[model samples]
Target: MILADLQSRLRIALTNTLVEEWTLFTPTTGTSRPSARTIAFHLGWYLRQTVERTWSVDSEYDRSGMVLEQAVQFDGDTRHVPDLIVHQRGLLGPEHNLLLAHVSVDEASGPDDVPELSSAQALQRRFGYRYAMLLDLRLHVEGRRASVTPYWQWATLEKGAESPEPVAVYTPRVLAEITERARRAGD
Candidate 1:
């Protein structure tokens, strides 16, 4: 699929996920925010609904049989498990590797924790994915309810692109309205 079409579909799915699964973002029991992996799973579910049945949406799928190269300065394990992926299972080529995404909630310790533009481009080169996305969602926890802040940004790197582009899926006003609805639901 073309980059614009893919991005539009992804935006719809992501917006649906946030609107429908707001409870996941806001925990009734504790103050702790949901993990990125947890949110990705839900996002993947929504993405699956938006795509054709042939497309498989998975979260934290590490067994793609592709190994990522580690940086010389970093001694830690280089196993790069994408938070979300859209592709056909068992097809290892770029044709089948539609999208690769890394998601992070709240504050990331460093670039390693959340892949930035350069790292996203490297992943696209190594994995041969048509697109790479970095989704940064910040949680604003108030008592038992938490809402995703408008500060969230979606950065995307297209195939052979020099740098990643920031795309606004929805207006901050829309996000605020949804957040208010979520907050009301919690009460």
Candidate 2:
């Protein structure tokens, strides 16, 4: 499958689930907000949906239990687990034939975390994944209504780069464009 096609599908799934579906759910607490694990589950679910929709064959996605072992400059070697991982059908191992997504939910008033990006870059460099996306969801809640804005960064081994740069802030229109482009390319 084409990498761009898969990426476009992922972008749409994330935008719809986070920006649209998440806001409608009522929070349990008056002040407390969704945690990183909560957001990770949602993102993982959407990623699974995208994989199922795009591929005809079987595939596997995990929210946990998969680790990318990397050798850091001073840390010797450490294991890093991404929020979501996608593996091709029947080939299940710690190999690099997988797609990865790392998620961070930033405070409403705070900037997107830099460490997340750095870690993602390190993973890309070590694993040489075909594609890796860093998703930072900035959340703000007013009274009972929640607002979420998503930022995306993508890394590809084709570029031969250690790190990825900020790509686009996700929106409904952007998702629509991606869908249309994929459709056109298919035709």
Candidate 3:
């Protein structure tokens, strides 16, 4: 369809995934859940930060740890949803342009990663995001309490930005705890 339609669809799907993960962790809790808006905002922040930056690099080593979340598609499996995102950048001034690109915003859009393309080198050239972050949400059980994780990060894909490799991965428990306060507000 259109970019607006696709963006909305992605947001909805991401929110659903977050909530689904949340439920899996806190299955017994009757507490209010985080809002879709909060998840989307947090995700957006990461997209603008991590993915946009490193994915554009020309590095040959693993860049997973440095980023909040990352995954590469292979074989016939192709469905992946990253938490944070940077839509698109402007050709002129930063203030004049937005992070969300017109095409990617579409629901029928294609994947950013091309198998033949190098993860770093093709990042910006193919995707064209100014920033990127992938939220890693998972369930953690400690004693009798359950928690959600949050993997928020900020990075840029601009040619001028730094190109550090990825590092350790964050779990859903970490992410939920970090944003727990604001997440409560979302309920």
Query: TM-score of every model?
Result: 0.80, 0.63, 0.33
Query: lDDT (CA) for every model shown?
Result: 0.68, 0.54, 0.35
- Give residue 61's error in model 1 in angstroms: 2.9
Backbone clashes in candidate 3 total 43
Name the best candidate (by TM-score): 1
Candidate 2 regions with alpha-carbon error over 4 angstroms: 23-30, 52-80, 89-96, 108-116, 160-165, 171-187
Task: Give the TM-score (vs. native) of candidate 3.
Answer: 0.33
Sliding window of 10 residues with minimal summed lDDT for model 3: 100-109
Model 2 has an lDDT value of: 0.54
Candidate 2's residue-wise lDDT over 1-187, tens digit each?
A: 4667877777666655554444323353445666555666666666666665433221224424454344421122433356666655445333534576666676543443334555665655554556666777666555654445567777665663334555556566864564354334333
Order of models, best TM-score first: 1, 2, 3
